[model samples]
Target: MTVATARAHPNIALVKYWGKADAASNLPATGSLSMTLDIFPTTTTVRIVDRDLDRVVFNGAEREGTVRDRVVRFLDHVRLLAGREDRAEVITENTVPSAAGLASSASGFAALAQAASTAYGLALDDRSLSRLARRGSGSAARSVIPRFAVWHAGSDEQSFAEPVQAPPIEMVIATVDAREKAVSSRDAMQRTAMTSPFYPAWVTSTAQTLESALEACRSGDLERLGRITETNALRMHAAIQGSDPSIRYLTPRSWAIFDAVAQLRGEGVLAWATADAGPNVCVISPPEHTAAVAERIGALADVVIARPGPGVRLQETDA
Candidate 1:
């Protein structure tokens, strides 16, 4: 059979989900809100193969070890859903900086889910696709939709993501360090969940922020939305930092960008910084300030301005 191809863009969480209630199921402890970026994406192709095991290639290199094993396991999901235990040949290309708090895995798994399901002849709706993607990577659930999407914490059937009806916002992503994080997001999340004394506090605070964020989005109040995004991300990182032995993803450069954001704010630019489990910072701002935000952030590190991107797209499929 010919390959099925899909493309999906990475997402930056505004209302972040830093811990999981069910790690095995990739179920979050709380819902997350995110904005899909048009700048970086993962393009994946999946084809049922004749081999006994799955064959996986990433970025033109054939992956091995734990990475290959994980990819094959993710492919097994599609096999089970199709009721055909066929191994697949999977190829993925990630444009986003790997493990740099850019949500590369979100795009990777979302593309895989869309391509693999179609290749296996399973016609899945957006909700079903989002649920399936979350099995591989929790944040992937939000990447299934473009603009703004919220991934709810619920049972497998009920926890899928739906898009927010709001104006698309631009984000200036500054790469403080393009190198992959020493600690993976999965490992860091689990450790923080186990050791952080403030985990519960964050969950409670995030619930309120989620509501306010949604309202801000609906009202086209970019300042409030930016504030919510920045504060929510800081709350998530605080929980991580308070863990035993701690995990600090932010660097001096990351904080420098934060200073730049504050400066930009005082200058009447509404840029606000948010980060995930890495040193990179994403500054949410109105489109008019995007170039200025990027220029200001560019002083500290590489910067890219991204607009709202499209959801996962099945580009090609063959029976």
Candidate 2:
């Protein structure tokens, strides 16, 4: 059988997804929007054959247990739709920094959904593939599209619809701490959902933030997007504080980078900081302001500034 492949790039949420309403369904506790990155993403290839073996390889290493199980679940879903249960060999490669809270799972699962469905000859649309990807991670649903994407917290089956339009916006993600985090997004959200007293408040506030951010995007107002995103991230962090046996993801360096951004803003640089469930910060600015943002960030610490780019799509081998 010929191998069918798909590639998906990861997205860093400007309005971060912190908690979950339904963990089993991977539904977010709140709706969120993200900017797909240019450099960091995952590529996956799947080949189906009439064999008894099911296999998966990640970056040349054979995987088993949870990772393998998740792939099988995705493939199984594809099989049901295609009306054939052919065994598949799955391979994935990540160009992003792993376990650094840079949305590795978002790109990873999105690629898998695209690759597996395509391999099985399922002519799934982006929305269909997004729903499949959401089964693996809530944020992954948004990574399936490029530019700006939103994950609406509606019904599990009806949620991952593609937007009719997206704004021209750009974000630069700065890796404050590119190391394995003590709390994974899954575990952190699970704990927050069950334990945090302010979880309800966070949800209500998230709706407001989502509306404001969407308006900002539509207006092509980067300043408005920046302010709303920064505020939303801070509120998400507050929810963590309200969690019992309180947990925090921000490192000193993370705050240092944040403070530097603030300082630059004070100096008239058009930049703002937003964070997810981890320490890394994503700075949002207009395309014209990206160089100024990068120079400002460079002074704070060693960081990479990615300009606004297209969403996840298949790469041409020769191009």
Error of 2 at 226 (Å): 0.9
Using alpha carbons, what is the TM-score of model 2?
Answer: 0.93
Clashing pairs in 2: 146-311
Tell me the tens digit of each residue's lDDT in model 1 across 1-319.
3479999999999899888888888988888889988878899999888888888899999999988987888877778888888888998998999988899999999999999888888899999999999999999988999888989997888888999965557898888888989999999988888899999898788878888988987898877888888889888889999988799999998989988999999999888999989999999887888899988889889888888899999885454
- Give candidate 2 misplaced runs (Cα > 4 Å): 164-168, 315-319
Candidate 1 lDDT at 158 equals 82
- Model 1 stretches with alpha carbons more than 4 Å out: 317-319
**lDDT tens digits, residues 1-319, model 2?**
2467778888878777877677777777678888777878698888776689789999999999988997887777778888987898888888877767888988898888877777778777888878888987787898888767888887787668355244555676777778888877787887787899988888998988988888887777778888888888888888987888788988887788789889878988788888887888888776777777777777655677675455556544321
Judging by lDDT against the true structure, name the best candidate: 1
Model 1 accuracy (lDDT, Cα): 0.88
Q: Give the C-alpha miss distance for residue 282 in model 2, angstroms.
A: 1.3
lDDT over C-alpha atoms for residue 243 of model 1: 87
Give each model a TM-score: 0.97, 0.93
